[model samples]
Target: MKAFDQLYQKHYPTVFRVAVKMLGDSDEAADVVQEVFLTLFQTMEKGMVVEYPLSWLYRTTLNKCIDKQKYNGRFQKLETAPEGQVEFQSIEKQETRIRVQRALGKLKPVERALAVMYSESLSYKEMAEATGIRFSSVGKTLSRTLKKLEAELKNKKYELY
Candidate 1:
């Protein structure tokens, strides 16, 4: 119990951030985080020993985000307007974040999960173990996911400049 609490404290922020990035809403992200922790607690109660708790938490959060997106169909629209048009500069930052989140939404759930894990510096082996996929597939999936994201961003007129 103490160990689980420590683990939750250590990893909750990262989990919530990832969830927010995936879901694009703080409220939904908070729900996903809570659900992830609750599920973790249930699994632990059932005597499930996760080999890599961080990876497990990340994968769970990613899955939860994907599930929510699927059920809500929130990814159908791409809200892309110039950030500068917003009244506040802070809204500009938010717009940029939303653009990125919308791009991420276009990816398949597995692809999104792989991209998130890779972006977070998780190695192929770690991703494989966490996602139950082959290590060799991780590189290819990540490459394809990146290409898809690039194409989506281009279509949305979100240029780097």
Candidate 2:
């Protein structure tokens, strides 16, 4: 329990962020994060060794978010988590985030997660370990996802520049 506390404290924010990036809704992201932690707790209670704890958490979070997204039957418009009283540096920054998220919403859930992590600059090796994607495919998949996202944005006149 003590160790779980420390682990949750360290990783919860990352899980929550990934969930939001994948699902585009803070409300749903919160639920997915809770589900991930609950699963972790249960798995640990069964004495399972988490080979790579962070990777496990990320993969689990992505799985739960995909499940939730499927259950909801539709995508929600992306919005900031609204973690009470947080301020954006500028309206331009906020708009950019929103536009990118809108483009992301058009992707399949796995692609959205990969694309978001790519935008965050995670290495292909890290993404592969976390998501169980082939390390070699990560680059090709990301390139395709990004090109698709770019085309979608272009249709909406939201230039990445």
Identify the candidate with maximal lDDT: 2
Q: Candidate 2's residue-wise lDDT over 21-110, tens digit each?
A: 888777778888998999999988898878788888888888787788788776764534345423745767666666777788788887
lDDT of each: 0.77, 0.79
User: In model 1, which regions exceed 4 Å deviation?
Assistant: 76-92, 158-161
Pairs that collide, model 1: none
Q: Model 1: per-residue lDDT, tens digit, 44-82?
A: 888989888988897788878888988877664234432
Question: How far off is residue 40 in model 2, in Å?
Answer: 0.4
Summing lDDT over every window of 10 consecutive residues in candidate 1, give the lowest-scoring window: 76-85
Which residue pairs show backbone clashes in model 2?
none
Question: Would you give me the overall lDDT of model 2?
Answer: 0.79
Q: What is the TM-score of candidate 1?
A: 0.81
Q: Every model's Cα RMSD, please?
A: 3.8, 3.0
Cα error of candidate 2 at position 46, Å: 1.6
